[model samples]
Target: MVQCLSHRVELAFKDAMKKAPLYSKVYSLMDELFKFYHKSAKQSAGLKSSFEALNITPCTPTRVGGTRWLGHTLTALNNIWKGYTAIVKHLSQVSVTTGQSATQPKALYLLKLLRSNDVITFAHFLTDVVAVLAQLSKALQKRETCLYEVHQQLLATISNIKKFQTRPGPELRKVQRPDGSFAGESLTGDTTQHSAQMPKLLTALVETLDRRFSDIDEGVLCATKLADMNAWPASLEDSTNG
Candidate 1:
């Protein structure tokens, strides 16, 4: 049952993300960027060199496996966020060094996409959103967790996510300008079209959570809380008096 709930939540998140235009593109880009380096020893070497040149610690991008769930996606996004400069640098070098080869054009295209405001904004937003979902995913997998605790945690997660409608995540806040445009290296300072989409995406996710968990009997789960001694009255007199 625990595993089933976990899978259901992850699938719900995936569905929500895929249906959101901004999120879908950013997610796909993450997978594409990882593969760009994964399939090429030369590009991987270039990425390492870029890291060294920029005095950043070397780390490889993680594969966003189709079946691995949101935790893996979080890791992949973290990798991209941490190594964004290194990736841009590597791609810049590849575009020039590869001359007229097909690799140069592909490298240039990816560089353009990665540096855009929409990708940057939505990618950071997802990093924050998925980080929350990933926490619930981890908690649900614990051996000692009970259905009552799971119920509480699910409610808490939904509440936390709804807050994102007004409060942007730490990562997403970094690139946003006061005027509603986004500012970052190579970004064109255009008003972020993606920021508007965040609320809709979050709403969809909350709805999905509600729909998916609707069948669970909250009253039954509440009753199970009595199994915990901590949930019991401190003394028999208190219980009888109540």
Candidate 2:
């Protein structure tokens, strides 16, 4: 650990002009901050808290089998992930009680959904991740594209449920004129009637989504911003040192 820390410092000072280049540029500052994060990850709670305070997201390098940063990320995320699964189970139980179909198995569905999705292009992708994450912890990023998509899906479902509840009830059809002729009554008369409180139920469902998903969006935005903040320094470092 000490050797890693020493090399890191030596490398920075070895090229101080290149790394900190007297300009006080925003990108340069971000570059320095990013370095601090890489080291902090291994040290103490300070790393996590500082990054959280700054709302920065640490970028795990893509090289396989390099440092343990990715492993730590997985660990941190898995802890949250476990809690997320429990939340899904709880929600599913509620769905069963209300006779609503459970969403396709949460983990598999989410993984499949992302297979056809882009991580950086659309905000909805971020929203979906955050919405799932919210049952456990809040993200530091906001994914409007993601949140908006969820909102749209939910709104559509609410509309369908509303129509189901409001279509002309059979009872109104049972009424007859003072004369002997009955109203146009379908003799089978056994259509499944929706609960009168369905509109209210639909409204409650929409409200719940609004509250829960809204927070996820906030988390996505914050997390993304943090990552960017951490990335800026690295970006500038690469550009200058190159």
Highest lDDT: give the candidate number: 1
In candidate 2 the C-alpha lDDT for residue 33 amounts to 27
- Residues 114-219 of candidate 1 have per-residue lDDT tens digits of 8777777788888889999999988887887787777778888999899899898898888776644333355744535686678878998998888777766567
Clashes of each: 0, 20
All models, RMSD in angstroms: 3.3, 26.6
Model 1's alpha-carbon lDDT is: 0.79
Instruction: TM-score for candidate 2, please give it.
Output: 0.19
- Highest TM-score: which candidate? 1
- lDDT (0 to 1) per candidate: 0.79, 0.31
lDDT of 2 by residue, 31-144 (tens): 332342244443224434433554545322111123433232234333322232332233333334433333324323332222211211111211222232231122112233
